[model samples]
Target chain A: MSWRSELQALRDDGFDVLDWLSATEEDDEVVVTACLVRSEDPGSFRLVRSPAPVESVVDMFPSAQWHERETAEMFGVTFEGLNAAPLLLPPDSPAPLRKAQPLPARLSQWPGEVDPAKPRRRQDPPGTPWR
Target chain B: MAMNPRASLELIAENCTSCMLCIRACPVWCLELDAHLEVDESSGRRRSSLALDRFSIDYGTCMMCGLCVDICPFEALEWSSELPPTQFEWRSE
Candidate 1:
């Protein structure tokens, strides 16, 4: 079965709800992702993701709510979900399918901490009258 | 028109530079830059529907998640002073 079919089958096996969905476009293609979980198996969950063009598995999951909307705006993927609106974007947005576009400044660049032991370049402390 | 009474709507249009980052970052589809988005006749590229128009925030439906301002590549969005302001000022290298 194809990825969409696999997702539908998984839904049939009681994975009836969608938790969220996200998409990222690469140089070659778009990647659509879905996170699935059910009430019965609260802790256990699975992720369904693939490169576009992705089929709308929205029919199988109602809570796919914002997930489908997000995928549409970020990657221009259409979903059979209720409405494909700017979930994380404005309706008047320009082409969102530019995979090479830089990520939002706040969302880009992971900053890690510096190693503590590597430094000994401390300048003299601020002047105090007592010193 | 109906945004949460609690959320503020402010637009810094000058800083917008006509980039649609705010337009593409709203989760609730509440932001509208009233512009003529047209398809380029020759290139078929989807260009602006209108020229530069003021952006509207539909508060009646807005979730006020701040994602719109967060995704704006330009500093075109003004924050509500009530909330902690996160602003990015661009400086030339």
Candidate 2:
């Protein structure tokens, strides 16, 4: 079944609490997860999806708005119909959590590059060859 | 009962083999280590050993989790009860 339909079904089944929503950037795509809970029950329901234009659950769960925004900002996941303002980082900042993202600190001179034994030979930082 | 309050992190340079286990284990990347290989042939046979040049921990970024001390294979890192001054520098003595 479609994720939207599944969410709607859960909501209809009295899953009133939207515990949390977040995303992780995998090697190829971003994975978005939403946790739902029912006050009557002790456990929670987790919904995981991998979509380029992920549907926004804000309409179903208002608390998902901020979590979706943060996930979007960090992993560059675009949630459809969710207009998010700049949260922790500036609007133009690169997606820091993406695997392809190059850390600015590693691009600069890293202290670990210094080798006391060999002055001529240099070692690249952890994340090198940004390409 | 006596409570030992955590303060500054101490580095026992002599015991440290520069294995870099602490640096790798640091979640915040606050620890930095630099070492070079030194070879000596004074005892008829050549012996190579890792000589630690510099080792530093950025207390500003350190959360004092004591993971580095616990992860040190050589027991090079330890916790000192003496509180560090506000402007104190973390240098390997």
Candidate 3:
């Protein structure tokens, strides 16, 4: 079933509260998850989707406006009908959370990379083996 | 009176191995550590050890979460009851 239809079905089944919405990068796509809860129940359900140009559920869940904006800006996920206004970052800034985005801190000289006693060989920065 | 008040973070320099664990574990990236390799050949056998050069914590950015104190495997970081000065200045010695 389509994510939109599933969300509609969930809304029909008393899952009225939108707990939170978040997204994570998985491989080349962004996996968006929305936590939904029933007001009378003690449990919550997660709705996951990875479709490109994910359909906006703002009409159903008004709280998704900011989440979609942040996920769109950070992970470069496109949300259809999202206001495209710059939220947290400047309009000219690149998507910072994307895997391909080069970290400015990584490019600069990390103090951990230098071993004063062993000047001949450079040491890798701790927790940054990818560099 | 509180038995264990978290007032200051003290570094036991003698026990530190310059492992960089505290710096990596810090959530705010407020900790900075500098070290160098020291080679010893007293017994006609060469051995290398890490010698700490500088370690500084930016209290302005640090949230006092104690993650660094708990993650220090060498017991280098500890909490003290002595409160930090109101107008504290951080300098790396």
**Docking verdict class for candidate 3:** acceptable
Give the root-mean-square deviation of each candidate in angstroms: 20.3, 3.5, 4.0
lDDT, candidate 1, A1-131, per-residue tens: 56689788888888777777887766677777777787697787888878766667656666666667766776676664346766667777754556444435324211111111222322221211122
Instruction: Give the least accurate 10-residue stretch of model 2 chain B, judged by summed lDDT.
Output: B84-93
Give the per-residue lDDT digits (tens) of candidate 3, residues B1-93: 775578778888888888877876776666777777888999899999988877777677677899989999999899977765433333336
Q: In TM-score terms, which candidate is top?
A: 2
- Listed models, DockQ each: 0.01, 0.41, 0.37
How much does candidate 2 score in TM-score?
0.77
* Regions of candidate 2 where Cα sits further than 4 Å from its true position: A114-131, B1-7, B24-27, B34-50, B65-67, B84-93
TM-score of chain B of each: 0.58, 0.83, 0.84
Candidate 3 lDDT, A1-106, residue by residue in tens: 7667777788889897777776877777778777788888848665656555678888998987888888888877787887867789988789898777866756
lDDT, candidates in the order shown: 0.58, 0.75, 0.75
Model 1 Cα lDDT, one tens digit per residue, B31-54: 555333334566676553333444
Which numbered prediction scores highest in DockQ against the true structure?
Answer: 2
Clashing residue pairs for model 2: none
Error of 1 at B54 (Å): 38
Error of 1 at B62 (Å): 27
